[model samples]
Target: MRGHDLINTCLPDELIVEIFHHIESKSTRDACSLVCRRWRRLERLSRSFIRIGATDSPDLFVHLISSRFSNVTTVHIDERISVPLPLSELVKKPDKGASSSSALKLHYMKENNGSTSAEGDFDSLCLSDAGLSALANGYPKLQKLKLIWCSNVTSKGLTSLARKCVSLKALDLQGCYVGDPGMAAVGQCCKNLEDLNLRFCEGVSDKGLVELAVGVGKSLKSLGIAACAKVSNITMEAVGSHCGSLQTLSLDSEFIHNEGVNAVAKGCPNLKALKLQCINLTDDALEAVGVSCLSLELLALYSFQRFTDKGLCAIGNGCKKLKNLTLSDCFFLSDKGLEAIATGCKELTHLEVNGCHNIGTFGLVSVGKFCKHLSELALLYCQKIGDGGLLRVGKGCKFLQALHLVDCSSIGDEAMCAIARGCRNLKKLHIRRCYEIGNKGIIAVGEHCRSLTDLSIRFCDRVGDEALIAIGEGCSLQYLNVSGCHKVGDAGLIAIARGCPQLCYLDVSVLQNLGDMAMTELGEHCPLIREIVISHCRQITDVGLAHLVKSCTMLESCHMVYCSGITSAGVATVVSSCLNIKKVLVEKWKVTPRTKRRAGSVISYLCVDL
Candidate 1:
């Protein structure tokens, strides 16, 4: 007769599971499980992913995984708590005489009493061999596992997991202490593993990597090793000789040199993506890559100054399929090398040139002329680039979609206007500290770029309210950031609020001219606005903040700092008015313990120091 009884009695178990499959929210599924015994069983059967904290009770965790969630296949155990604590609990002060560390120890002891082995100590608060053994026994079907900052776990625990979870395909051991023996066990047992990341695993060395390469052999497809000092050219040789099917490899080490890279290029002909950083490599290594790895599609070289135009030219001539290339801090690279790439790699779609002062108009012009299909371009701190280069690019690359210009002092209004006129399909544009650009350029963008949704102009003192007003009248912007644009005022913001009702994210920080009128307009028109940053807007007062909070009920995040007119009362009003507010970043002086307590468990108050 009742709604609940009708649903329970009418719907079959199979139909209920079909409906459950459509519900993706974990909280909704958890609530459903609490309804009845049948729903709990069904929910557990449908759930496949779970994340647990290392500090959780080992016994209870094993019991829950085995009995409640039998179908789980992906598990993540992190040393950090899965659920963030309430602001009140996070900021709560300890007793007068007791230190915070002592209080934490006492809490840990109370929560984990009798849950650890006799050999356990302070370090035992984190997951250890005992927990891994329990997980192996309970979740034998686990396919993916991520252990983050679980320093207590060693090779012994990994061996236990590998022996049972033979179906594991991906393992991420970021910041773990596992060394050679553990990697050897995983290599020997988990033959199906395809992806492995050992970033920040300081204890691993050449022997471990060699064993892993030998055991996994051709099954391994992706490998990432970074900041492991003990790994050297030996590991590279082993990987090149054994892992013939490898497609993706990223290495960030100071020890690997030309010999190591040459081996990888010679062996792994199917490699499609390669990233190397902080290595003392020469032109010989790059030349080897160009001649051997013809299937390479993506290559990123960073902080390597020894390679010159000759090496890059080889890469361009050989790797015809290369589509994405990024060069950063390569001081020797000039127009000659880039021109070679532009001439050879016509299919290139994305290019980023950063901190390379030698690259200028000639290189960029070559890109505009040859790379007709290019869609994205980013130039950062390239001091030699001027409007001449961009003007050519704007006229040539008609299909360009995204452009990022940062700290390029030589660029001016001519280039921006040219891009606005040419790139009609542009969706995102970011300009930072390009002082020569102003209202004329932005107005052109507003008039021409009808599909533009994301625009960010920071520290460009020349930009004013007219630019924003034009954008508001023309484009349907979803994200707008005018931070550090001193010329932007309330008039511009009001126009934006009235015109772009779909605006969801706005950053008007450091605008001294903006006031309450802009906030009122935003609250009235932009009902969907969810996040706002009004830091350093001294003209804004509590009256405006209250008005904004009262109307914008969907506001989820509000960041207010250094606003001289706003007080504690304004912060309290925001906490109480916006029911959906999850994060409030405010000055430390304005928020008291009482306000934080009132925020309760759902809202997080991040207090910033003055």
Candidate 2:
């Protein structure tokens, strides 16, 4: 039907509103609201809003907040994505001018008057007081709110939201964009909040934290305030005094060092999980936590630069019942720490030491010897975990369910054979960048882990189509990432398409050899596929992309980074078809001016539904 004919036949307003509940693409549903006055009423009554992507334009920004976006949770400002911000606040500041060298940096943009260009580039969607008030009035039933990098948001926003939304529970204001005043406002007003994630909200001080502790400690169960540059021992002591029943806590390495760990050790009697992320914490803090929070079962500390064998040993001495541990960047850890864990934490199930450069064969051997119950392990980027380490782990960990050896350069086919012989319960495996382990290793995965669900072998040069064919045929997989491997071409993609009927997410990013045949095959076989990354795949053209978009109605996201064959036509085809697409990434696809205008039109439809 022509546009006018289709308009006349457009379903009744009530019918459209019913359909909106099932539709997820924010822009498309918003466009429906603009179709007619009757549709607008339907959109309003349907309560269709989920995520609101912010822009810097004051007018558009204000209009958005004023709009009645029902369920306005998980807001994403374009600024956080288009104009990327630094993540330097993840580190501790050294004395004197060392602020320049902190791991994360803050860069804020001034308010803009006009809507950003159709280019979709934006400095974070900074909210003003008026905007906040408008938001409070508009979204009185929001459940989750995210101001990840919105620097201009102050305490007033929190107060406004709190006064309006009685059911608000989760809030993420990481990266200090929302400061102490705003945080204090949130604590005071949003008392029923259960999960508060302030990962790097640097402007927050101890006093604000105290107010938070006093207001929501009883109701709050999970809280992560990691990477706050201003957190001191006094504030931690305050938390200890008041926030006694927390089930989960995340502290920066610096905060844990200044006797704050001792406070939590003594104060939080019901804590079960903790994430001590950052690089400044000392071993004493771990010891204190072990002695203080005796019930800790899950621990995630990615980058304690000072953490070593001695520090981990202290953990073995203390947190004996550890069930899950991720020590990704603890570079100085050695066999002694593993020995201690093996001897003490008998229930150790999930373990990840992604970049612990010091751990070697001895550590794996000890874990194999003592931690017989070890089920999941990640030794990614640990260059020293060689074949010997894999041999020991495979033999010892009989119940191992998942193993990630990504970037372990010393691991070879010998490790694969060992793994194939043992660890029959494996479900998920990632071996990216271990070039020495070729087809043999991957074949072992297929033969051994018949229950595998998720698999990733990015940059594993030795593996090819043969291994994927085996995996795709043997295991009913759900997720797979085979990017950066050149030798695995159409055959592998075809095998996966034919075998893995449940595959939803496929990441073939940087694998340039994938052709139209593979893309077509995916569209034909994987009807359940939702996401695919074709970044740097030069062989893919509009033919394959259009097929994928047209056939895969479930496609929600597609990345065309450096896939030069992509043009405005292909993108337009996506807009007209794949009705579920919520996100599309094409950095330099050379969209014509007309195509850019079309893209802008698409954005207008997707902004946010009231």
Candidate 3:
């Protein structure tokens, strides 16, 4: 009855549809589908159609198309959930029109065969022939097709599909096994393509890219070809010559140089975002970007180790409307570059200076005073930043919404307090691997940051139960990670249960002090918990895990790595009690053995030593 009252009142059908447009997650909309018929109608019509996750059964699509008004325009299958290792092959042009799936098939690792790692019988990319035929027969309105890491999707099969789907706009072929021929077929077929991301498409050479530039030059708006190692001035020159109206271009890689930059400057007058990462771009390239691409708003120059304040100052003097800037790994930038940014760009909202250690707290203070509208700031690997710099940020940038100070080990709890007391609207805070912050900072955050939805203090050794209690009391936190924090135990877990009832994702793994009682508390309190990782927590025996399964209904992924106490019965109970359990993590290899309802899919976690 209480839950019924809390549900938002529905508006008119059109208004509800408009409201649903901004909701990014498909699962949330699926849940709302049960609310009312009007909501279902609105969910279908909502503009954003980003489908992501593990439950992408072929039947789901078949069901979706049969709906009254199916409007799933965009779908994104992220690797975080469903890591499809398909055996896909490109169909050559000869059999493209006649063959159903061509010779190309993306075959995912059929681990049902019991192959362990890549050491086992590696299956080729293969998609179901029936599914491919179904896709070709139906869904002609599909605009964007992202075959990311789908190595088996052959060019011939794509060509056939391309012929049927005339309205295709965007295509991402990143990490695919396709070559120049595949790109050529795409260029010939997908005429209305506006965005093309070919990152790590290693087979593509100067010729294929040139063909694409000539074919989709006028139409292509957003193009990302990051890490295509074979690229030279030939590709960029063609892009500059043909793709004149290009709005976004990512060339932040090793293979391209300033000649490409010069060509782009000469041709593409409307480029708004340009990424020239790792290119041999000296001050001359900056001059070109400054003088030619005046409409540019975002400019990321990673690996510009030789670049100094002069080059940045040139950009600042020229591109006054620039809003977002990333100079990660550019150690040459100092007070002069900082001053250039402070003086030139008043609309600056996002700034990242990772590895730029020369400029100290003073430069950041200047930034806080100037860039008041700044929403996202990342100082990853910036060693010079201290408590004073953070204090200055707290005082000046009251509207700062997100901050990431990962790997900056010098600052302590004082900085976190300052952030909590000052930046009240902070939505996301990630101080991962910052060893200095402790319980005091956690307490401050719990007391103040009323709207914090994401918090990660991973590797912050000094944090303990007090911090967890504070976070729990804060109530609104949805994601929390205290991984590698050894001091926290059941007290902290109790605090989390008492305070934050809306927690969906949690990682308290490697916290040696955390015991079975805390797990029981988490299970009881965080009923809405979707993902929980407690690997290496030796204290949490099967009894505690059992308690958790009994309490939390929606436990999807349970990671109990190195927690030898979790035996067959405990795992079986989770398999039974947590009906949605799709994956479980153990020691090394992920064993996706059958439980009851859903078969476990993936059980893998990796964090390379830094």
Best by lDDT: 1
Locate the minimum summed-lDDT window of 10 residues in model 2.
101-110
Q: Write the per-residue lDDT of candidate 3 for residues 46-123, one digit (tens) a residue.
A: 744544333323322332342434565554543235435322122123344653332222112132223555633333
Better of 1 and 2 by TM-score: 1
For model 1, give the 10-residue run with minimal summed lDDT: 83-92
Q: Write the per-residue lDDT of candidate 1 for residues 170-231, one digit (tens) a residue.
A: 99999999999999998999999889999999989999889999999779988898999999
Candidate 1 off by > 4 Å = 1-7, 53-67, 80-82, 85-121, 600-610
TM-score for each prediction?
A: 0.91, 0.74, 0.77
1-610: candidate 2 lDDT, tens digit per residue: 4546464376776677678788777788778889787777677667634434444443234444345455455444333554222222222345566654232211112233333665424432354555556666766776676666666667766667777876778877776356566667777777788888777677787778888778877777787876777777777787788777778888764545637767877888778898877565777777777666668889887777776677677667777778898887787778788778778787888888878888888888878777888888888788887788889888888898888877777889889878877988888887778889898888888877889898988888778899999888788888999888888899998999999888899999887778899988888888888888887898888899877776788988877767777766777777668777767776533445665665543332122221
Give me the overall lDDT of model 2: 0.73
Between candidates 1 and 2, which one is better according to lDDT?
1
What are the lDDT figures for the candidates, one per model? Answer: 0.87, 0.73, 0.74
Give the Cα-based TM-score of candidate 2 against the true structure: 0.74
Supply the global lDDT for candidate 1. 0.87
After superposition, candidate 3 runs with Cα above 4 Å error: 1-124, 127-142, 150-166, 177-190, 588-610
